[model samples]
Structure formats: structure tokens, C-alpha cells
Target: MSNARLPSFRFLIGFEAAARLGSYSRAAEELCISQSAVSHQIAQLEEQVGQPLFRRKGRGVELTVSGRLLLDSVGKSLDQIRSGLSRIETYMDDSLVTLVCPAPVVKGWLQPRVDRLLQEHPALCPIISIDETARYIDEMDVDIAITREPLKQRGVLEVPLLDDELVAVVRPDSDGQPAGMLCLETDLTSDRIGPFIREHFGNLRRLAIYDDPRLLLDAALRGHGVALLSRLLADEALRSGQLRHLAAYPSLPLGTLWISRTEGEPRLPLVRQVFDSLLAYSKG
Candidate 1:
């Protein structure tokens, strides 16, 4: 098909739906079509897009990098149209949604949820706040936030998501040796390294803290201080032996992440949609 005629919004919509939801059956249900129809539409769209959009994994699916890029490209136009219609119906208000999260959590946890968000609520545009500078965080003005501390906020409503946990970590290469002052990429005291310090050494010594976990993992490999980190964040380090659990200590209570939204504002359907998606996303 020619580029001009290739948009095939129906096909693109179906494919995007299938790719993001990870199932042709669900996509079909959402589109009010048969599963076979959903598959044929996606297959045709894939041929036009000139690449495979999804890889079958047993009963579910996962998108390829190209699939992700296509969704990104076409998502905004679709969202705009959807939001415009929503506004015309005077059924909901416009919205801007934002989230705040630590870098590692952004990388491991939230990244996987974006696609599902697109599939579930195509009209809600989102911006993610990842790099949390002390000054910037204080000045942040967002509609929704995912924060570690559920401290009092002026206008935000906070709903706790899950309990964050800290696990021991080290470099994949080095033998777990020496084991004194635990080395971390950055300010360990703030990242929950204090408990390990009190437990392991009896006296807390805040020595040799790097701002990067790569360096801390290096030191841990070289038999430095035990690296305390989130199990989700340190999975690769644990798997490769770059980080190792020094003791079977009870997982550290890093704190609970909350879904914070501004109070008093009407719940935009898109926002409520994403909120529901996230809640279900949490269960999964």
C-alpha cells in the first residue's frame, strides 16, 4: 500500500490494541470483534509496517522495539482525536498526568507499564518525572505523582501502591570478600543502608559512597561494604554475581509508593482510566 493510503487507522488501532494488551482475544473483546479478525488485522498491519509487531509467548504476547516505536508515533494523533471527541461530548475535562519515581524503579518497574497504559487509555497523555534533583523535586507541580514518602502534601491525594524493599547487592564478577564498609553508588544512608550498617558493623561508618551504583557494585565485587539496594533494581547484579546477598536479612522496608493526584479536581475519565489501569497493573 502507498504511504498516503497506509495509515489504515482501523488496522493500526487494532494492532496497537493487540500489541499493548498482549492478547488478540482481549483486543478483540475491546474492539467487539472475533479473535481471528484481530489476528488477521494485526498480520496485515505488520506486513504494511514491514516488521513483526509482536512475538507470541504462550498464551500472551510482547511487543518488539519497532512495535513500541510505531505505537509512540501514532499514539498522540489517536489520543488527540479521542480527547477531542471526549471534550465535544462535554463529558470530561482535559488533563495532564505526571508521575515521579526513582531512576531504577523507572527503569525496571514503570517502563513495562507504559505500553499497557497506551492500550488501556489512549486519550491520557503522560509525562514521567525520573531524574529527581533535590531542588527540582521541591518545585515540582504535577497532577499525579508516584512518590516514596507519603508525607503530607498540600493539594495531592496519595494512595499507597506497594511496600518498597531493599536487598543486598554486589558485582557479578567479584568474590564477596573483605565485607566491611558497604560500598554503594551514592548516599547509602538515605537509600536504607543505615540498617545494615547498624546490624553488621554495630557502628555506622559512612565511608566511600559513590553516586553511581556501577561504582558501588565494583567496590562490592572488590570486597568492600555490602551494597544494599532494591531487589527489583539489583536483580541483574544478583543474577550475574556482581552483587550478592550477604545475609538473609529481612528485606528492608524502603517505604510505600503512593499514587498522588491533586484534590478537588474532577476525575478526568482518562485519569480515572489510567488510575484503574495502574491499580490492575499493580495486581499483575
Candidate 2:
């Protein structure tokens, strides 16, 4: 097809809308433009085709024979365009794998390894959903969920990601005092490390208690207090000399981190690829 012979798509769109609705005003309303603008575009389209596409009747318009033929062709073309666009959107959505996990896991684990995963699988997109409660995955639509909590849901594939150990961390220069205890008061911590804290730091005064590990980690980094944090979360800080590990306290075993997906749903190739990458990264 010759490029010069092609009609203005804008004009055709206006023409089709006006013709289909039998009212230029209604078309303008649907297109969010002035009624005069719709009329002007239709007039331009008619001029291009060398024939009137609409006949003014009362307050509305009627399609002429030429208009009817053009409307038929334009409608089909626009429908095809819409269908193709919809397919593209679905494909983009399919390329994304939604990962639901706690905020600490997102900050401590996934953020560090995400760039490498993306580099390896250029076609895959990972969407992170942070939920500390770990209850939303079963209630909401999620492709994969990582949680320290055991999955009670049936027909789900669960793979062990990491065995997180809890350790007391503080800023490099600090007086390890009882008043400098920064406690993370989450359900997971309460269940796993509560006894450990009582047994070890029973006389220690709590500087602050946080429900989120990320917040606890932040407080510890600022030299507010010594925080009992996941080894994974404090790893970077410890390695870089940003935070120092207190030698007096013993490390407490928290639990295993597990990545799970619904079993019945059709596992797309991209989802599998993302899961495998995450598994490998966590293991490493």
C-alpha cells in the first residue's frame, strides 16, 4: 500500500464514532472532545474520500451509502487494532510473576538478587508484594508467596528457600549495655526468639520494639540499640563493617523460608524460570 494514499486515522476514528452513534455530539462526548471538533474531523474525512460520510437530519446525523461502506471497513479495522492491543497487554501481564513476601525479605534478600535474576532472564518481570502478615497470599491473587509461616493451603508447591538464623547486631562502635536492646516484636520473632531473649537478655531494657524487621534493622544501623535480626538481613551490614555482631549472645535459629505457588494453575514458563532463579539464588 502507498503511504501517501492512506487516510488520516484521527479523521477515520472521528468519522467512525460519529457514524456509529448517529450524533457528532455523542461521539465528542465519548472521545472527550468538543462537538465542533468532531464535526471538523468528519468533514475532513469526507473531503479525503471525495464523498459525504454523514447527512444532517434534525439534531442528529444519518450515514450515507458511502458513509455506511466506510463505517463497515473502519469499524473492522478499529476492532482488529483493539484486539491486537488487548493481546499485547495480556502478554505483558503474563511475562510478570507476582512475588508475595515480607518487607524484610524484599529488602534483605530479593532486592540484592533481583538484578542478577533480571540479567539472566531478560524476558521475565518480577512484581514484589510485601505483606508481613503472610495471610494475604491465600486471600489475594498471587503467583508465588515466600513466608517463614508454614503453608496450610492444599495443592500448593512449597520449596525451602533459606534457613534464617537470628543474631544480635549493632553499630560498630557501641557500648553493649542492657538499655541498648532493640527488640523486633513480630509474631515470628515472638514465637521463635522470645524464649531466647528471655533466657539471654532477660535483664536488658528494651530501647524500642518494632513489628517489622526492616525497621528494627534501621534502628540498629542508626546506633539506637542492638537488634536481634536475621543473619541474611544483617549480612551486608556486618560484611561492610556498618554493623558489628555482639559475641556474648548465641545465634537463635528462626525458621526456614519457603517459596510456594498454587499447584492447579497452569505454570507458565516465565513463572517456572523466576521460581528456579529465586531458588538457586537463595540456596547460593
Candidate 3:
């Protein structure tokens, strides 16, 4: 139980490398030092242990009984140290929360309330990224995800965030006659919305087509044309009188938006808090 006579880290590192590689020169090359340094360190380790750890072989070196025993303990220690460092790096900034959201959700929903969310939780550091395809939520390291579809996987908890409907939105100040139609590509691909638009509004000129509904919302706000977009996305604008539901077209039923996080015990309380806050915000 004497802590005073422990071998130095440098000696242990040199010893482990030399014993594993069976060559002081190879250990030195791996350690980015000269063979003399490796030899010196190992010699010091041997002096401290009061036993010779290596034996001369034909061209390389071989581990003696003591050397092999030390290497086993030293290698395990190094592995644990490396794993500890990696775990520590993740906690260096606990306030940092990563979120992956679809572009439409980010622009129309999250972007508008970001200022208020921070005001409520000033210490929170949010890193929000757009993942329209929802790839990062399943494949990458993220704290929260908002997607059009729910993720049903082990250890993942997904809940409905908002129930939305597809509607044609136009600027409030618009005269009865609009310029053209602005459409989301996905809406046009939907079985219901796609065929409905073609049958009813086919006579109207198509001004612009966009893959992202955020873009369609923007174009509608700018008076470019009538935008076929989700009501959830246009809610802020509609409430502010910047945009209005085009009364001529019936609102088509869209689906529920989902908010998801890993199930069971949470790593960070802030992630759970933020997730709950978002759900509450959506309901409000």
C-alpha cells in the first residue's frame, strides 16, 4: 500500500510500448521519440520494480515473466484512461443542447420562438440544425428531433407535437385576383393534395415550386403567389394578419408532426426540460 514508489507514467508508457512491440526502436518510432529515450525509460522502470522486465532475443526483444505481467495491467489502465477522457469531453459544456429539425419546422416554428426560449432559459446553449430527411436523428448524436414522421425504435420516445392541415395561404392585403400559385413539391406528391390542386387550381399559373415548405411560406408572404403549405407553418403569419387562408380552397387534412427523444433515463435534465417546453409551446 506504499504510494511513494510508483513508476512514472512515462516509464509505464515506454514499458508497455516496448513490451508489446518487442523492439525498443519500434516503440520509439510509435512514441515519436528516439530508441535511447525508450531504453532509458524502461531501464528506470526496471530499477523501480527491482527486476529485469525484458530479455534479449535473436533480433528483437521478448517480455520476461515480470514484463508480461506489468503489460497486462498497464494496457488495461491506458484503455480506461482513454475512455474516461472521451466521456469527460462530452460534459465539458453541459448547457450545449443539440437539436435536429426539418427546415419547415425550424423556419416556421422554432425560429420564431428561439428568442423567447432563450429568454426563459438564458443559460441554455442551443445548436439547432435542419435535417429535412430526418437522417441525423437516427444516425447522429443529437438531444432532440422534430420530424414529420414518428421514429419507432428501441429506446426512442416519439410523441405527436402538432396536428396540421394543408391550406393555400395568401397575403392579407391581396386583391381577390392573385398572381400565380406557389407549391411545395411534397404537397404536390401527396395522393390527395396533388390531384386536388391539379383538378381545381390547374388553370392558375404555377409561379414557383419548392421542396421546402418554408420557402413556399416565404414566397406567399412576399406576395409572389398563393402558397400551398401547412397551417402549422403559416400560423404565426395568419395570426399577425400577414397571411390568410385562401377561402376559395378547402383546407386539406395533413398529418401530425412529431417530437422525439431517447426513452428512459435522461443524460441531461435540460434536454428533457427543453423537450417538454417545446411540446407545451406547440400546444399553446
Candidate 4:
């Protein structure tokens, strides 16, 4: 259509809302504008079309014959525009992935491997957050969650990520004295190594109790005391000889890490790609 012949897009939108709703006041509310604004736009649209679109009836308004025809066309065009915009939104979301996991996992494992994953999948964008309070996985607005608790919800996909041993760890340069033990005050303690630590190292002074694994790991790294740390969390430190595992103490099962998501939700390609990369990295 020529520029002069084309109606104002804004006017058309106002007309569509007013016609579909049959109330200029209602349309104004929907469009977050004043009723007079909707009226003015509809007036401009009628002037452009050379015919009245709406006729004032008793206490309300109704579309005229010409208004009805224009409404039909305008509605369909708006619907198509909305559909196109929705598709674009979905496409944008495909490049973004939101991940939630424990603070320890983020600091110790995922953070270290994220650069590699991003490098391999250049289009991937990750938003990582920590949730150590054991919140329900499905309650959060996250694409993927690495949780310690088993998700029993139906239509949720859960993958076994890691099952590592918890061992007493300390800085290599320390005197190796068992002054105290840094402990994580998490469910992992009650489920896996809590009893073992209590029974074996009960007499030793308690160094600190932390809600986050990163804090406990930090205390151990600083040579404050021995810490019962997951093999996965201490992997890099042990490998580089920054921390030493006490051979005298036997390791306990640390518990399995499960990566999960709502199965019914459409999986974005980037989400799947990142999920697979995380699984592989965890296994390593």
C-alpha cells in the first residue's frame, strides 16, 4: 500500500481493541491509556477510512457494517503479528539457559567447566543461580536444576550426574593436625556422611559449620582444619597438590547429584546441549 493510503498502525491497533471489546473505555484499559486517547485514535481511523467504524448505542457501542468488515481484517492482521512476535521470543529464549544448583557445585564444579561449555557452544547463554535451601525444582523458573534431593514429580526428567566419595581434606602445607573439622550443615550430612563424621571425629573440635560447601572448602583450603569434602569439589585442589587427602581416614559415600527439568516443557536446543555438557563434565 502507498504511504498516503495506509492507515496509521497505531490507530488500527486502537480500532481493533475498541471494536473487539465493543467499548472505548475497555480498550483504553487494555492499552493502558486514557479513554479519550482511544476515542481520538478511533476518530482518526474513521476519518482515514471515510466511514464511521462504531455507532453509539444506548449505554454502549456497536460496530457498523463497514466497521465489522474492517474489524475482521484488523483482527487477523493483529493475530498474525502477535504470532510472529511470539515465535521471535521463543527463538531468543533458545539462546538463553537458566540453571540452578547448589553453591558448592557452582563454585567447585560448574564454574570451572562453564568457560569450556560456552566456548564449544558459542550461541549458548547461561544464567546460573545457587539454591542451597533444597527448594522444589519445579517451583523455580529455571531450565535445569542440579539438586541433591530426588525429584518425584511426574513428567520430570532426572539424570544421575555424580556419585563421589567424601574424604577428609586439608592444605598440603599444614601440620596435618586434627585441630577441628569444617562441616557443611546440609541434608547430605544427614543422608550420607553425617553419621560417619560424628562417630569417627566426634572428639575433635568443630572448626565451623556452614550452609554452603564453598565455605567449608575454603576453610579447609586456608588450613583452618580438616574438612569432609566431596571428591568432586576437591578434585582440582587435590590434583594440583594444593590440598591433601588424609589416608588415615576412610572416605564415605557423598551421595549422588541429580540434574533435572520439567519433561513436559518444550526443551530448548541450547538447554539440551548444556545439559549434556554438564552431565559429561560431572562424570569426568
* Clash tally, candidates in order: 15, 0, 0, 0
TM-score comparison, 1 vs 2, better candidate:
2
After superposition, candidate 4 runs with Cα above 4 Å error: 1-91, 132-140, 185-194, 262-266
Error of 2 at 240 (Å): 3.3
Superior by TM-score: candidate 2 or candidate 4: 2
- lDDT, candidate 1, 103-137, per-residue tens: 67665467767887887776666767774542122
Model 3 per-residue lDDT at 105: 66
- After superposing candidate 1 on the true structure, give the runs of residues whose Cα lies further than 4 Å from its correct spot: 1-96, 131-141, 170-182, 185-192, 201-208, 213-226, 235-250, 264-267
Q: In candidate 3, what are the lDDT values of residues 167-246, reduced to their tens digit?
A: 88898788878888999787778788899889877888999999877778888989998888888788788888999888
User: RMSD, each candidate, Å?
Assistant: 15.8, 11.3, 9.5, 11.2
In model 4, the Cα lDDT at residue 188 comes to: 34
lDDT for model 3: 0.83
Residues 21-66 of candidate 4 have per-residue lDDT tens digits of 8899999999999999999998988888888889998756899999
Cα misplacement distance, residue 156 of candidate 1 (Å): 3.1
**Which 10-residue window of candidate 1 scores lowest in summed lDDT?**
133-142
C-alpha local distance difference test of each model? 0.64, 0.79, 0.83, 0.81
- Evaluated at residue 197, the lDDT of candidate 1 is 50
After aligning candidate 1 to the native by TM-score, how far in Å is the CA of 104 from where it should be?
3.4
lDDT of 2 by residue, 1-284 (tens): 23447789888888888888899999999999999999899887777778887898999999999889888989999999999786556545766777888777787778878889889989877768785454334423466888887686787778788888888888888864635688777633665567788888767778798877788889988988778898878767887888988878898887898888766443567776777788988767
Better of 1 and 3 by lDDT: 3
Residue 6, model 4, lDDT: 82
Winning candidate number (TM-score): 3
